[model samples]
Target: MPNSEFSGCRWAVVLLVMAAASPSWAAPIEQSDTPLPADCDGLKKLSLPLEDAPPASMASSLKGCSSEDLYFGIGVPKDPVRARQCAYVERQDPDNGWPNLFAGTGMLMTIYANGIGAPRNFDIAMKFACELGGAPAEEEGWLAHLQKLKNENWQGQDFSPCDDITSGAAMGFCEAHGAKLASAARKAKLADITAHWPSAERKAFAALEKAKNTYAAAVADNEVDMSGTARGALSIAAREAEDEQFLATLEKVISGNLPSVSPPDLAETDNKLNALYSKIQKKKDTSDWGTVTKAGIKKTERTWLIYRDAFVSFAKRNFPSVAPESLKRVLTEDRIKSLENFGN
Candidate 1:
């Protein structure tokens, strides 16, 4: 990533001057890697009487093996059984003083729903998504949406064929196809419309748009399986690879390397960041948090922002920490999770 790209982040004139004084790449690893504990088989062999164990006992049993950390943009790459067990423990003790178990459940479910660490399964995803009574109950119009995929497929990308929405694999495969197709089409449309966009974000828009297409092109050959986590990983890898261009460009600009710094584009992204921050606030305002206070939301978000900005340079320098969009995505997601599960 370039130094000039850093300008897109939140900044005041003074900070900009200071940042310019010593522009450098920085990355922060969220958690230390640890050895994986008992797999599903090992977990089953535990003679600790799981079935009859009370919720507290179960929760106590999983201690020291429940950290939900992962790399910057990977979300929680949970151990399938550990994540499942995490949910089970939480479900058994939903009223724990610290609902972190439920938090772990939500993380695992997110991975399951998206097929991040394992093959995607709609039923399992829904099972996890609905754990907190926050997701919509099964209803009509749902299957209709999943079945709509039969009519679309990225123009020519061999989207996996699916005939039954009842199958989690089919539903997930179709949804992934539709979403990717829609994303590609949307980018094409944006490219055409950018000619009319205000000049400030025009160049930046073009860069990002091109970056996205480059990413798509890189993965164009392989058959994209939306029902599995590999495809998602590919997307992340491609995007991270391309975002480096932004940093590369930024680096030149910071050292007076580029012809001009284009304050307009910086303003544009800044506006977007602020808007997203406010959006989270609005979501918090309306969400029901049982006993958790809105102050928790504010405090957590602020801490996240601090942590996020601190590593901007390092992330730009490193290939995988996170891009700007990834940073916002994780933060927004973490905020929403907090709202949904207060103790999280």
Candidate 2:
């Protein structure tokens, strides 16, 4: 992969919505040119440091509880109040690193702008937006946009922070928020499903989880075309889909629902896969494969081969009655489908 794509993935891996509150409506506040207070009185009004401000603790704590998940109803009920409180606490803390600060500020902007927990307050939203400090022109764009909405008496429920995203970086930030929510939900589900397994099974499950995650990462990095502006978001979506599929497959495995295969079937699938790969290799010179080069395809295939072997080894220990060739057949068939796309 190119260095730019790698950097984009790093930006995505490291980075990590709204509703109405009351039935009664209030007229939008008039836009003001008033200079924002140095201390940001809006934040102070919340009486933040809602608890003792532990140095460098808010980010990890918020992630653990998944403030976004709660607010957006990803895996749990929507609780904008809880989400607002969590983000507000972090927003007040000056000791946080830049990334966390940016994240907290963005969350608060969404909450206030949408009237999710508190009353819709575009002034407060603009306050948070000003702190975002993107490029000067971008910052001006945000302020102007928010100011127009406020002046026009726009309803908070009608707008979202993401609706105005124009740049790739900003779109990436928005998409990453969603990916985090999905990941949090996925983690909660896997934990619930495996909570009562025997110790040895649990150990094997952990190994399986690690292997799948590694393979998922490889697919995101190597399989997806990263030449577009949406590459970061695209990669994130692909990785999340891979994880969901892995979880679904695991559930099916535990239920013994995967089709059993004979040794001859395995041999046939292996031969088909080898022939398809060679055909794909031949098409590399003439076909439009987008961002995925022939070399990248080979690397991804190698990674999948390793993952298949690891999975088969795990299945041998845990399911001794299951034939090894059956496992190989299933994985090889899936790989064949993916490789066939290259030829198409």
Q: Output the number of the TM-score-best candidate.
A: 2
Each prediction's number of clashing residue pairs: 16, 0
| lDDT tens per residue, model 1, 89-202 | 444443421212123433443444334444443333323332322212221122222123222211222111122123222233234333433344444444564556567556
Q: Model 2, 83-194: lDDT tens per residue? A: 7766655555544333231245666666666677767666767766666544345456666666676676767453445555455566676567656766877888889987
Quote each prediction's TM-score.
0.24, 0.65
Residue 271, model 1, lDDT: 61
lDDT of 2 at 175: 66
